[model samples]
Target: MKVKAYITLKEGVLDPQGKAVEHALLSLGFQGVSGVRVGKYITFDIQVRSEAQARDQVEKMCQKLLANTTIESYQFEIIQS
Candidate 1:
């Protein structure tokens, strides 16, 4: 199975990286972008038989190390290939 994790800053959390990107975009004359938020994307392949097991393990991984649950939120979807 292939796992794709998207980790992002929680609402109300300050993100310097996103801020920098927003500023840069505005400076580049992209005024349509009112706000911007940045997040992380992680992709990996695992040999899991079922999506349920994968979801369980992935959630554990996220809590243990993959994501900072204190200030960040994460969502993942698995693709079988």
Candidate 2:
């Protein structure tokens, strides 16, 4: 199974990179832009046979290495590949 993880800053946490991108867009004359949040997309293959197992392992991966958990949040999707 192929899994994708989306890691993002939690609410109330300041995102400097997101702010920079937003500022750049405003400087480039882009209008109607209010807020921007930058995040990370990570994809990998897991050798799990079942979706339940895959989700369990993926959640462990996120908690252990992929996300901060305190200031960051993560969501994942399983794709058959």
* Pairs of residues at least 3 apart in sequence or in different chains that clash in candidate 1: none
lDDT of 2 by residue, 1-81 (tens): 999999999999999999999999999999888679999999999997799999999999999999999999999999987
Cand. 2 Cα-lDDT: 0.95
Alpha-carbon local distance difference test for all models: 0.93, 0.95
Q: Quote model 1's TM-score.
A: 0.94
Show how many residue pairs clash in every candidate, following the order shown.
Answer: 0, 0
TM-score for candidate 2: 0.95
Q: Which parts of model 2 are misplaced by more than 4 Å?
A: none
Minimal lDDT window, size 10, model 2: 31-40
TM-score of each: 0.94, 0.95
lDDT of model 2 at position 81? 76
